[model samples]
Target: MYNDLSNEELFGPSDYSETSDSESNNEVSPCSFNEPINNISYTTFPSISGLILYENLLSHKQQNELINGIVEANYFDNPESNQAMCFGTLPSFLLNAIEIISRVPGLFPDEIQNREPLFDQACSIINLYKPGEGIASHVDLPRFEDGIVVISLLSSCVMQFKPLSVIEQGDDNNDNASYYNKFKDIQNTDEPIPIILRPGSVLALSGSSRYNWTHGIEENEIDEAGDEKIIRNIRVSVTLRKMKQDQLLLNKDDSNSFSLEVKKREH
Candidate 1:
């Protein structure tokens, strides 16, 4: 992974708050999401689902091997942003997905107009999910001042945005204060919309749905084969964005560990 650099800082840790306090409101919406032009399903989180099928980006021979690697990465890597990122052999589909996302304008007029390409920078992320493999609710804090663009491939999951982490960091596991606040906030919807993204579906999580909203896919529940059998989902996702301007890319071979200070990024 990451060019076999043994000393590469795998990922920034969870406590790393690497953005400055200068915040600007970025208005975004899923408006263009429903248009027939893209033929893309425009569904809100935990609310809707659809299918977008792209042709073979990879040959039959290549798909078999790469798919297995994608599955393995999701199982072995940490979901937290401040941990080792899952970097395995990327499928052709994942790369193409990011290429498409990189060019698409932002969801809202303001989002893309202010920041073309809508983000300072971005990257590709592929994930795997076995039965009971779920990501708990968490705001993509700090770095997400600019939203994340996620394109889903292979399987589908209920991705929803509401609220979480409303109390002191401690004891939040049992408390519903944060949960309820988020629930109340989005109660106006006739129903909760969980975007069920199947393979080939591209979703841009920018708009009013940016960092202001928190979304995650519930653990997959499909255990087709026995425990001995390694059946699982191979989902490729690319999180493209405008990184905080002036923030230094974490040098892979940079031996700058043990210094976990959050750097202030000037706009």
Candidate 2:
């Protein structure tokens, strides 16, 4: 739960309005490219359903504040190793970030928006990555429900997404080997769709994009953004998720079959 903060504190007073004048008969607004809220623009990838990139979601000052907060927490004691911290509850330091996101109209599902606290569980994973360090392609744990939000800070990186190929576990009792091969084949393919995540950008994933695709960054010192090459830097990513009521454990059988659908670059 959060205290009542004025719209001026969340967004510039002149940029946002808290009045009901914009709402006609209490109709909810849909998050689309045509209708941008709070001077924030977004790009949606056709290749992956429910994948949205909210560009410049936070100001430079806000980004710095988050980075400083993470540093002060002493979560990154070893500068040489990649580390991650998981939170079952929302930390006081992250309230500002969550508040800023909740202020954006129509970015989340209606039911979620209607909730008083927005997210009930408010589980989060904060990852600190050094240059040339990257994570493997994998899906989030099944314990989390849909509507996963990721906010990137400090430096920009390229994240690639590829649809998973279904492999029936029938007769193949070795699930580990099956999953390893599937991920290896999917990631080794040349048809992955890459998206550049700039500083203070928010990436939302749900539906097919959330469940059917594998997203990860490559281990490279340099990443390509269109024609320009960006040198990788120390970066921090905050991934927010809501835990399911059942708190189900990871299910290897939940992998769904998906076909390739590569859409043109829209970012």
Give the top-scoring candidate (lDDT): 2
| TM-score for candidate 1, residues paired by index | 0.47
- Runs off by more than 4 Å, candidate 1: 1-95, 105-110, 113-123, 163-192, 220-234, 249-267
Record all residue pairs in model 2 with backbone atoms less than 3 Å apart, i.e. clashing. none
Each model's RMSD to truth, in Å? 14.3, 11.9
How well does each candidate superpose onto the true structure, as a TM-score?
Answer: 0.47, 0.70
Per residue, candidate 2 scores C-alpha lDDT tens digits across 24-111 of 1222232332234544566667668877777666765676677777777666665543445343444555767777776776566677
Name the best candidate (by TM-score). 2
What tens-digit string does per-residue lDDT give for candidate 1 at 136-178? 5444434334456554444444455553333422222323345
Per-residue lDDT of 113 in model 1: 41
Against the hidden true structure, what lDDT does model 1 obtain? 0.37
Clashes in predicted model 2: 0
